[model samples]
Target: EHIKNYSKHIDEFRSQANSQGIWLFISTLGCWSVNIPLIQVIAAILLFCIFIFNSKQDMTEKRAFHKIEEDIAKDIDSNLIGDSRKARLYDLGLVEKYRKAIKPVLKTSPIFIVCYIFYSISFLVFFSNLFPRMKLIFNF
Candidate 1:
């Protein structure tokens, strides 16, 4: 019964974590598109909203994971070596789930890095063109 409950809790936490990661990945990309003149204020606002929601989500998942750990610890305190082993296995499963949860973030990390570099270069180009003095410092 405890193991089944543990599995359910972990599954829920995993799903939420992965969903949050997806939102983070989206926001990272959407950052480059933010501009008042470009009429993407709505996207900016939505991204911020998602960020806030994800923050709450992160908290919830953390609490759930912590609760599971505490429950397992209590089981171990009862001197049940079998349950202790099961708890350790469950912990390993959670670690695996976490790795899967971050897949979207890992997959998009390189893309985000590239986009950030390009965005920075483009912004510098625009800035140097608009303010000729800045170009002297950049040595461009």
Candidate 2:
């Protein structure tokens, strides 16, 4: 009964963690699309913090779950070892789910990086051109 409850809890936590990761990935890339410098910086920082903290928490939970699996394995009968092993397998399944969920986000990062680089280059070009144009207009 306790094992069943633990399995359910692990599943719920895994799903939540995966969802958070997806959000983080989306927000990180979305930051690049933001034109306002101040807002872009703020949003990027917040999203970075969320990603880091959530990743740390996920690691902690995974370790704890692994420990629980070990303990349960030790306590159960030999015939039940198969069931105990299934719990460990479920942990791996959760990780794979997270990886699959996060894949699109991961793919977007390089695209965002290229876009940001291009944005910076264009901004520099515009500012350079604007300086000369402004001087010509003001006779400076």
Candidate 3:
């Protein structure tokens, strides 16, 4: 069902968003050491950019799901079930609750976005060879 797909998309995007934060932080930390190599730094910068792009894609997907849910909710509420006042009211209330719950995402997402940008810039400046060196040091 469409609702099921909406839930799935939101869940998947949420995880992607979390990873954006984690990887950005890791990339920033990697740049802190002095002995990290150039290739490793380049790789980390590339990886961070990739993660940021993926996060943006995920956010777009999430917005699509949210819009779909809103449209479906509107369609259901606008037609059919002529006499089920209580049920319709309950559904409307639930929809409003869901909308409110997701509203904080608008605020929170920007903070994460800004943090990621700063992290990427810092990683490029201070840790260009950091990621490759990490692989050897961690024996990965």
lDDT (C-alpha, whole model) for all candidates: 0.56, 0.56, 0.58
Q: How does candidate 3 score on lDDT?
A: 0.58
Query: Tens-digit lDDT track for model 3 on 37-122?
Result: 66566766676677767777756463555576677667666764666645655655554455457564555455456657777566
TM-score winner between candidates 2 and 3: 3
- What are the per-residue Cα lDDT tens digits for candidate 1 across 6-74? 566555544555555465565646655555523444554465577567656565345545566566657
TM-score for each model: 0.39, 0.37, 0.42
Record all residue pairs in model 3 with backbone atoms less than 3 Å apart, i.e. clashing.
31-127, 37-129, 40-132, 41-128, 41-129
Residue pairs with clashing backbones, model 1: none
lDDT score for candidate 1 against the true structure: 0.56
Candidate 3 lDDT for residue 135: 47
For candidate 3, which ten residues in a row score worst on lDDT? 131-140
| Tens-digit lDDT track of model 2 for 11-115 | 555555556655655665677677777676677667667766875576434546666655655555444557666775566455445434656435534444444
**Highest lDDT scorer:** 3
